[model samples]
Target: MNQSELRELLSTEGLRLLDSLPAWHSSDEIVRTIAELRKAGHSPGLVAAVLSQSKLRAKAASKFGPFAERMLFTEAGLEQATRLSVAAQHAGRFSKAGVKWVADLGCGIGADALAIAALDLNVTAVERDETTAAIAAFNLAPWHNAQVVHGDAESADLAGIDGIYLDPARRDARVRLTNPADWTPSLDFAFGLAERYPTGIKLGPGIDRDLIPDNAEAQWVSVGREVVELGLWFGTVARPGIRRAALVIGDHGTAELTAAADSEDEAAGELGQYLYEPDGSVIRARLIGDLARQLNARMLDTSIAYFSADAAVATPFATCFEIVADFALDKRSLKKELASRKIGTLEIKKRGVDIDPATFRTSLSLKGENSATLILTRVGGKRRALLAQRTTFAETSAATA
Candidate 1:
């Protein structure tokens, strides 16, 4: 949004209209609403700005929760905003470290600052973009302790700051910048701050391992099925002796696995009744061996992450599937096996394989009413397909012991 649209959206009338509008749904409804607003004598700019905000608010709900209703958003700001649940953890870290004040650098739309302030801590939310700063200021207005700084994050005055949180903008013109040097505020600047104070840096899950500072605690977090962010903590906030951690937040509840460094991989062993696919965070943190040991499971292959165990152990770090049948890794065999079972619903998963699940699904021509998960992988240097059924929470609990 430009300055003109921003000005209109920030106006008293504009905000009132935005809150008064019906919850946004389809684009077809936009046409009629636009016409109605135009007939009501609202300027084209105001109508466009409010409608856009309404639409953005709908999309922002996934990340911001109910706060999206009262908050203003820029498309890019909303895209980069941290989920409120994750932000709460960031705040809890600073609080647990006994840090009284936090400087949330690169505070897009003030998501982190909101959480920090909600914890009753003094927070300085700094944003380089003027429009985003204004939106953040508005979103954080509910908190008396939160303040927004419209300036360069690197230049933000940190006079009384007890700790700092940095989330550098890793995108330019909506394009992802893989190189840390290209990121605004730069990873170097973030690492430099870590040396002086309790610092927390948020980066993409797939960041190069070499870029991670050896002394900092690198924690990879997954919410539901996807790995979301890698948080690097330093100084007092960094837990002692813990250099790597995998935090899993999912349907089973929150579970964490931590280690000093990457644990040695367990020896590849025979397939058991249960197969465990480690969560992405566990895989990225390279804590598979540690998790496997906890579950009494072993790697099914040296290079593959899949694990096999005798018991149906329930753990948040991985999804457990009961292996039903195995077949030679070939389409003809799979077709015949699938046909015999009358399998219609196929949840195809793969590791160390070249097949594309979607395109391969078409090849199988599944049409049965039943559902099953087909794991295409390697076992003992041989390609094979394993048909498995997902263990429900109840089944997993029953098998746990």
Candidate 2:
């Protein structure tokens, strides 16, 4: 949004209109709301701005929860903002290190800053865009210890800051920039801050491992099975003896695996009763071996992420499936066999395979009463298809008991 639109959105009248509007659900509702507002004599800009904000707030709920209702957001700022749950963890790192004040560079709608302030710590949130900075100020207004500044993050004054949190803008013109140098404030500048102060740098999960500093603790975080971002903690913020970690956050809570170095890979072995698929964060952190060892499992193939074990070992690091049958990779024979068993609903999972699940599912033209999961991957250098039944924790427990 532009400067004027943002100003209008934060105005008394604009906020009143936004508050009066219900949650935005679809395009039809938005059109109807626009017509009703226009008929009530609201300006086109104000109506548009308020409606846009309503939609943005609705979308932000997933990231910010209840706080989204009271905050203002720009499209780009909202897109780049960290999830509140994850940001709380970041704040905890600073708080635990006895950091009383922090500078949140590239704060983006003040998400991380908000988390810091919620812990009763002081935060100076910096943003380059004036509109975003204004939105951040509005979002952080309730916190007495937080403030927002519109300026270049690299030049932001850090005179009395106890720690730093840097979330470099990784997108340009709505497109994600893959190279570290392309990020705003640049990786060089962000990393340079860590040399002087305790710092946490938020980066994309697929960041090149070579670029990571040797002294820093690199962490991969996943929220609800999706690997969200990689965080590099340096100086005092880096936990002692922990150089690499995979943090998984789910509905149940959070779990983490830490190591001084990459875990050794487990030996590839024959498929057994169950198959385990490691979470993305575990795979990204190269901690799959740690999880495999916990389950008493081994890799299904030397080069694949899938694991196999003789017993149903429950673990949060991976999803376990019970092996029902294994067969050659021929589609015709597989289809004939499935048809004979009256298997219909299928969950096709694959790794180290070139096939697209959707296209393959359509090709099968499946129709039956039974539901089953399929694992299509390489086994001992040969293509194989394993039909499996997904096993939940409760089912496993009941069966073993």
Candidate 3:
């Protein structure tokens, strides 16, 4: 939001109204709410701003949890903000390293700062966007140990800070900036901070691996099976002999796999009784070999991340599927085979293949009461389809990254 609208939303009347409104829902009648709000003697701008914030608060709940109730946010700021649970891990590193004070540069909406302050550590959060900085200040007002500064992160004063965390702005005016150099406080500047203090840089999981510094500990973190961020830690916070790591958080709890480097893959073998799909974080961390070894599994294809085993294994790092049937990659024959089995409810999974699952589903024109999963991939360097059922160890789909 712009400065004027921000002022309106922060006003006593606006905040009270926002708090009084019912939680936003997709099915909620927007026109009626706007009319009712306008008729209540609130200005049009104030009503619009508060309504927008109410919706944003609902969306922010996924990341901020209960804290979202009292927090303020900008659309872009909330989008880039770290999930509180994940941010707590980032905060723990500094705490474990005995860093009492942290400089959270480019701290969008003060997410990481909130996590840090919750640990009883002092934090200085800096942001360049005027509106976002104000929103961050509102969110952080509850933490006496936290301070918000409206200034450039590259020039933010880090004098007494024991640790530094930088999340460079990767977007501009709602458009993503793909070039690393385009990032505000550029990688050159953020990475250079490691020379002066313990530093942590949060990057997208898809960032080029070659761009990562050899000295940093690259940790790929996944929440609920979704690979979220790649955090590179340097100096005291960086763990020795841990160059690559996968941190997975799920309903079952958290699981971690770390290695000094990418582990060598086990030799590809013939199709086994079960298939295991590694979580995105594991695949991104390049520790699939390590995970496979832990599960006593081998790769289905040397080039694919899919693993095959003689028996089902229960592990949080991967999802298990019991193979029921295998078929050649022929559309007509596959359709006939599925129809013969009365298969209707379908979960399509694919790797090392070109077909889109949705299109294939439509092409099949399926109609049956029974449910089954279809896995389209390569076996022995040739296309094949496997009909399988999710085993007890699997919680849900570990979506392909």
Candidate 4:
């Protein structure tokens, strides 16, 4: 018996064969099982199915054929599989503006493809693996306009697509990016696509700022306070300012926001009565510079991410905090005060210093029933941490920067 024979066994008697094999996690076990099936005289399809269905590769096996085996299990796949909201965001960017013909290049698992199709856009999804292509087809079966094509996208004919969304293989199917560039879409292909149409390329947060083409508009995106993916928009959609987007999902619904760059004068002078902290994406995109002006807030520290102003001007970018208490670093005094109150739950936040929150929590030996939000960082070139509680003043924020 050979590979052909083993495959036959699986097609004709898959359940029977599965029960007889020992459980294992390694690909080696699958190889060994194939060998055993061959010795027992199985068919090629049976062998293929069995190997593909092995626990180690069950998902890939379920979704793809042999060619897709290279996809392997990966973090990116898991993220794509689990984070439907993120994919929907990518899709919404194009679909919301009435772009109907969308191309989802490198559409792994058809996550973004499904999202675009759900928005009533006709999508052409291209994948390099037969298995992944097949799986994508199955995933898009409900959408009449969603088609999955098997091939390399770089050379694929994409003449009619009105808008293109590219989610490059930022990581191997196993999801670890040994070299970040290894998973990125080819720069030439990406730029070409952007030059041709309204295109968005998904990128890792660690992408170099300098690498972004001057003609393209770059955005930093964060979802739920976690900076997830960066996006580059080109062609007709490109703009000059950096875009920061934040997404907030709540019980009622979802809220998304995008803030562009600002050139307002920096706020100076004394610490105001209120402090505002912008969303991470806003801070990263330097949208806070504009947001501060809108909120009438000034920078607390030139380099610090926090903002301060005398009056509160309502804005979505920053969360306003009524200044509760500000003090210098008096470890002994603070510890004694907390110890007397039996403050056990200590929250430490710091900027500029390499202090570990855990060590500080331990050192304080704070044991108290009262809980407080702590800010640990340098203020005006001094090292200190502030303690406060969350206020009703919510900074409706998103994850896109």
Most lDDT-accurate candidate: 1
lDDT of 2 by residue, 1-401 (tens): 99889888888999999999887786556677779999999999999999899889999999999999999998878878899999999999999999999999999889999999999999999999888888899999999999999999989999999899999998888888888788998999998999999999999899989998899999999999999999999988999999989999988699998999889999999999999999999899898898899888888886899999988876777888999999987889888988888988999999988899898888887889999998999888788999999899897787557
* Count of backbone collisions within predicted model 2: 0
Instruction: Report lDDT (Cα) of residue 117, candidate 2.
Output: 99
lDDT of each: 0.92, 0.91, 0.91, 0.65
Query: In candidate 3, how many Å is residue 186 off?
Result: 0.8
Off by over 4 Å in 2: 399-401
**lDDT (Cα, tens digit) per residue for candidate 1, span 1-401:** 89999999999999999999987886557788889999999999999999999999999888877888999999888877888888988999999999999999999999999999999999999999998999999999999999999999888999999999999999998899988998989999999999999999999999999999899999999988789999999999999999999988866667899999998899999989999999999999999998899899988898999999989887888899999998888998798889889999999999988999999889997877789999999988788899999998789888884
User: Residue 129: error of model 1 in Å?
Assistant: 0.8
RMSD (Cα, Å) of candidate 2? 1.3
Which is better, 1 or 2, measured by lDDT? 1
Estimate candidate 1's RMSD in Å: 1.4
Itemize residue pairs with steric clashes in candidate 2.
none
lDDT of 4 by residue, 10-107 (tens): 34386466545554355455566677788888766766655554453444442333423332233235345424566677677786556779888888
Candidate 1's C-alpha runs over 4 A off are none
> What are the runs in model 4 whose C-alpha is more than 4 Å off?
1-76, 96-98, 129-131, 173-181, 238-265, 311-315, 393-401
